[model samples]
Target: MKEYNTVFPNLIDDRYFFQDISIDKLPIMDKYNGMINVSAYTDAAEYINAQDVTFYGAWLLNMLEERLIALENYLVYDVEKPELVSYTNTEPTGVPVGYCWT
Candidate 1:
């Protein structure tokens, strides 16, 4: 996997991503059923630069596409080789069958 710094060089030393802020400390409230509100804390422009966002978005899309292709290949392998599938019994004594891809 690529390091965070390698993917986002400009954000390497940025505190927003690295800082461990507790979610409980945030100004959040359940106003209604399935509805919530939270306060904004950072400068939007600093966090959402067009160039950086675009680059990261494209990179994320590419990574997701690659993963999807890999998963498709694995599924195809399972379909092609039914004899290779096996089952294992867990502590509860339930058998779950699955393909073991190397």
Candidate 2:
């Protein structure tokens, strides 16, 4: 069950093996009939898929159940509270020495 469209980026599943984006297909043929063996493309789609899961609305409900359980274990510990720092929000800070230092 495969479909082609302009927005394939918006329709990828993460839990299954995607042969098209696997290590065997790492090398791609360019427009000039040249083979480019790029390492990043091999797993790039998987990383992007993970990012999508992280940012998807209520996606945490699907993924964070384990993390929530792990966090619950720490609830029993009486950790010391860290000091809260305050700062003025009038402008953006951390400008470089010369580039857009205004």
Candidate 3:
């Protein structure tokens, strides 16, 4: 068996930096009948508010942007790098064509 080791600076290690939030019994009325029901309810989102952060957080964001740019470049790759050749095939009788059409 073989093992690989990876190391990085002891930076931010908290994955779930934001807390989970739940909004129950949210108002969701039917547009046609104007009737409210439990089936018509919606959910509020739990998101990270990055208003306050350290320099490490900003540096992580910059690294993410660079990675996204690299991914975009890989997606829009052009396979055809050469120009097509042009040709002419005609007879001296001014018939204007030859085996090029066949």
Candidate 4:
């Protein structure tokens, strides 16, 4: 199902994905082109979607594009096999043939 006007820092299923702010959980800033309305904290629609909301907000769209690229390349861990058995426990820990726990 398609959810409308939703946003999250990371997937809810992630073990370490922490929810930042309640305001961030909703698409309140989306109406303002993803600007943080410090003045009008109640109604997001009250905030104008101007580019010059702030020096950072002014370039938010550009920043977001860059951020998405970084996120796409984010690595929780090495996808390929890692060297885990460093002489301490070289025996197989029941992992896949080429997998190791770090």
Which number leads on TM-score? 1
Name model 4 segments beyond 4 Å from true: 1-58, 76-93, 96-102
- Clash count of each predicted structure: 0, 0, 0, 0
Task: Score candidate 2 by lDDT.
Answer: 0.36
Scored against the true structure, residue 42 in model 3 reaches a CA lDDT of 24
lDDT of 3 by residue, 1-102 (tens): 111111112233334243322233122211211322233322211011122222223445655555555545545562333323335464323333332321
lDDT of 2 at 52: 17
C-alpha lDDT (0 to 100) for residue 64 of candidate 4: 57
Q: How much does candidate 1 score in TM-score? A: 0.26
Q: Which residue pairs in model 2 clash with each other?
A: none
Top candidate by lDDT: 4
Error in Å for residue 89 of model 3: 24
Clashes of 2: 0
Candidate 1: tens digits of C-alpha lDDT, residues 71-91: 576577645654544444533
Model 3, stretches more than 4 Å misplaced? 1-56, 78-102
Can you give the TM-score per candidate against the true fold?
0.26, 0.19, 0.23, 0.23
* Cα-lDDT of candidate 4: 0.41
- The lDDT of each candidate is 0.37, 0.36, 0.31, 0.41
